[model samples]
Target: MSTLPAYVVFGEALTDFIRQSDGRWAAQPGGACWNVACVGVRLGVAAGYAGSVSNDLFGDALYMLAAEAGLDMRFTQRFDAPPLLAMVPSTQPPEYFFIGEGSADLRFDPDRLPVGWRSAAQILHFGCISLAREPLASKLVEVALAAHLAGKRIAFDPNWRNLMTHAAYRDTFHVMAGITDYLKVSDEDLQHLFPGINQREAIAHLRALAPFAQIMVTRGAAGMSLFCDGIEYTQPAFPVTVADTVGCGDAAMGGWMASLLRQPDAAPATHLRFAAATAALVATRTGAYAPCWEEVSSLLAQQITESPHAQ
Candidate 1:
């Protein structure tokens, strides 16, 4: 089998506090880039995660989960502080509460980046809370700019959270956008970050900001749209009985990256179809669980049967 392209996902990895029926809580390994890395590895992609973790139990669990998911762990750091935690409210629209103060994830230092790590990666994916903090955010910016100068493909998912209202976060958003090659943002994210801006206006604004970048906007349930190479193509999301919406977007990102890395010259429509299908399937399950390739293949087949022109 041909070796898949290497992917480096840099950001925070934390425990997600999920609500249970008994009014209790269950902790699961999560974080946007972490989910993407897991799903990418499960999809047969060579993936690595770069970030810091506390030397606590939660951090150890994350390390174990990353190994089990087949993610390369050479660059992960463990510190003496506590691990970051995110409390996710169980509702139709999820709400996030971050609880990380002087935690390990925020202590990531770019100087400690693994030796020869960037040499193996074809793409570097980063965003979310990673871009909202200090030291780490500045370090990520340095790496991203260096990668861009090296002509490597860069994938960015703003994954904007409410905390972005902070000046540092907003500033990083614009700074990162300039160096991104592929940009993904949710409809809600766009509105939250740039309120009073319509989709068309947002697209135009982003295009002007990063003229060479391909922009993708995902609308939950409705589907996603791609604006690239001076054209727009949209793919409707697959129909599925959603058990939980967690990890669905990350699944989409992973699937999209997998397809693009495998078929660099494929049409944007084909990319969107694969991503949307994978995301829909993920929504049918709970937590950060990812469907196997066979499951995605079955869904793709069904999608084609339902809409012959999907690709």
Candidate 2:
């Protein structure tokens, strides 16, 4: 039998049709949770993905991409439903349009999960549209709660989208937040949850819900902040030439989990620093590809040389 994965991600796997300003388009296979699994694999973590993929060309490509990234697909489901599509504007976040009412990625069946999968993984990651809609949404919660009860760490990155009704988002938010062991939230995600609030207030709100969870809030260019057990740590973003912002947060979350899993005794500050460096490297490139460990180290070395106090 094959070795079990250390990390398992449950979410959607879909395509993004990014429209360029010059009338060209690029189709990419990316979903927030899918990115976490792929990036974790690329960062040398044993990761598995539990999501639905259509049997279409795009779905085939995404499946191959996951395989290439060294992710275990034993729990991946395939269906006849068409792949989900998103219209990504060059200047704005991607706007999703479900290709078919019953898309493959949204058809995840919790009852059909691989036997012993709960004990096979050390951590279960959740986020994105998988937590927003129907049967799948409820199923995801059921699985997450099971994992938590089984003593597996739960990592979440809400990756909130307006496509989900405010009520749905609120409910999902509280349920996951209550049980999350490691959480990655963005300023944007918080703003959507609590309108017109500043970062401190947002953190306070999240802390009240998940008091013991190690929460990391990504603050774009200003960098990220960490809160755990009444203590807070902040780290500035690594200085890097910008390429595009695509997959930046996913990379950071992936790196953070990878670092923590490997060095369980490391401080939260150490984890955030490594994660920030990984995110900076991804920002210096295009697409959702993960950076090699050396790449992140080299960037960190340079940052340390340039700014003695950095990281």
The model with the greatest lDDT is: 2
Write the residue-wise lDDT of candidate 1 on 96-207 in tens digits. 7999988899888777766666777899998888888777788898889898898888999989887678887877888788888888888888888778989778777878
Per-prediction TM-score, please?
0.93, 0.94
Candidate 2 lDDT over residue span 45-89, tens digit each: 888889989999989999998888888888788998878777676
Cα-lDDT of candidate 1: 0.82
Candidate 2: worst-modelled 10 consecutive residues by lDDT: 302-311
Per-model tally of clashing residue pairs: 0, 0
Give residue 59's lDDT in candidate 1 (0 to 100): 95
Each prediction's RMSD to truth:
2.5, 2.2
Full-model lDDT, candidate 2 = 0.84
